[model samples]
Target: MSAPSTVLVTGGAGFIGSHACAELLDHGYELIVVDDYSNSAPQVFARVQRVAGRFVGAVYELDIRDRQALSAVFDRHTVDAVVHFAGLKSVGASTRRPAEYYDTNVGGTTALLRTMHEHGVHQLVFSSSCSIYGEAGALPLDESVPARPTGPYASSTWTCEGILADVCRHRPEYTVVCLRCFNAVGAHPSGLLGENPRGTPDNLMPFLAQVAVGRRDRLQVFGDDYPTPDGTAVRDYIHVMDTVDAHRVALDHLADGPGMRVYNLGAGRGSSVFDVVRSFSRACGRPLPYEIAPRRPGDVATLVADASAVARDWGWRPSRGLDDMCEDAWRFQRLNPYGYEGSARRPGADRRSDGGPPIR
Candidate 1:
């Protein structure tokens, strides 16, 4: 039999990346994780090994924008495909720092693509977002809808999709699968890994988890006067594991043929902000404190996914429900109140001053 494919995972030390690494390793694929640790803690590599029961091939603390350093990683490993997940991903932050977002998200992607071309590593599963759909005219947004990104972060992803499309037009050998994911919440069920954003948490799940664990005083309900069932904005929150599984399936689909493909990865159901808070409160066994605030600028009323295309084409489906998402998220937060940084201080845990133990 042929050797297993070696996948290069950008931002592998982050929230979703760490789960992806665990999944990839469990499936017997080699991993070369590259991350700058700018938005993630490096301790995750160790947890990945523990979860997978094997060592990753390698881990490089390098930025994707650094062409030379990234090229060196390519030289050292026989990378077969790439799962690109290393980009600035905050919508609000993107609005404030559009130039920085463009430089990192678009510019970094440009550099990574160039280096991949130089090395002839063409297969890529890009981590795109549904925010690119902006305020869609219809509910249950599908891949066929015209992209109308509203903020810099979403625009950066939209720009990358266009670049990949153009690149594919010129390079038929390249296969790119853009997974326009909806909200990715929850941690791995093992409670070993979860979303651990640096500084204040931006996403609702993490913020809610923090509040439940007393890391934060209360939750901030952004809006409750929108035109929805509960007057709050609604979104499709997919468990992180489900999102990671979609990436794996995308890779397999790409291996079968070489062409550009896009899929919406979501649960195909909408849950309002109040819905999530109630779910999380049940998970934590108490009512979490919160206050309703005015709707933020550019906030969409509802953003659900059709997700029928992926089911039809790839036969992929999300098995986890909203309750599973809440329970797993709270478990991770309750266990690691301070995240991986706190993991080091646990009894018998090997603590490293420079971001956990070295890879493997």
Candidate 2:
């Protein structure tokens, strides 16, 4: 790693991106953030500054798919590396709007790569998902397994990784780190920032948090007839803090003679829907209401991560457990019932110059 001092973070105001910006600032890297507030709010950067006690270099409200706008970002700053977290992340939504997913996820990645090349910037850390491994092989899947993405979202992620690999193969100067992540839950533990999904929350933990905070009457568990021990779908849930920390570690390793390196970032275990409900019940000091429903289309029964490779490579592992995820997530939900609804918008200077469509 060549000690990158500046980072351009796409989707910086979003859930994981915001946290990563704060983490990077703490590590003494200048930050230039880009997000259109599609799934996030602008006020997030203010809270991020408060947490880090450091001001970001700049923030731009623009869709990354706009090459002209993205190039403007690089033109303004000497971005040494980029941590990309921008995309439509919902699994079900991707299945429904497969075209949107492609136009944004795959298209945005290609645009970002082209811009990076033009500016002579090659190091990149991509926020990928374990969903790309969907329904393939057995439990505790590793990186060696062939990618057989089952859903549109997973396929988009797989496509992005392939694009990065192709770029590396052609341009060995490019350093790319792809983190194939499992379910990312929990908040910063500060209660200031967390997952604030618009309208209906898609992920399991955020939905459960909404129920705990009385935002919803009850959560609808998808299925309880899966072949798992608990007869419910299972997933590996890692705290959001741990997830962002992995990005930082990967960034630090980018200068270590890199072509392309992929690692699985996860807790190396599974948590069922019922198990999360019970955990959140204890965290919120009451049993949240829930009912079993038919399994949603493209939902995986069980997805666990064999993150031993990341541990061996980066010496990083998830220290937080499911209880911690529940506690922290509940804290954020309990503190903000509306989830950044009325929080002030404090995005730094550099508003979008060109009109662009927001991520939908």
lDDT of 2 by residue, 6-74 (tens): 999999999999989988998899998898788898878778988999988888888888888788778
**TM-scores, each model vs. reference:** 0.94, 0.95
Clashing pairs in 2: 1-255, 1-256
The number of clashing residue pairs in model 2 is: 2
User: On residues 52-127, what C-alpha lDDT tens digit does candidate 1 reach at each position?
Assistant: 9988887777778989878878887799899999999988788888999999999999999999999988899999
Q: Note the Cα lDDT for every prediction shown.
A: 0.88, 0.89
Off by over 4 Å in 2: 343-360
| Clashing pairs in model 1, backbone N/Cα/C closer than 3 A | none
The segments of candidate 1 whose C-alpha lies over 4 angstroms from its true place after superposition are 1-4, 342-360
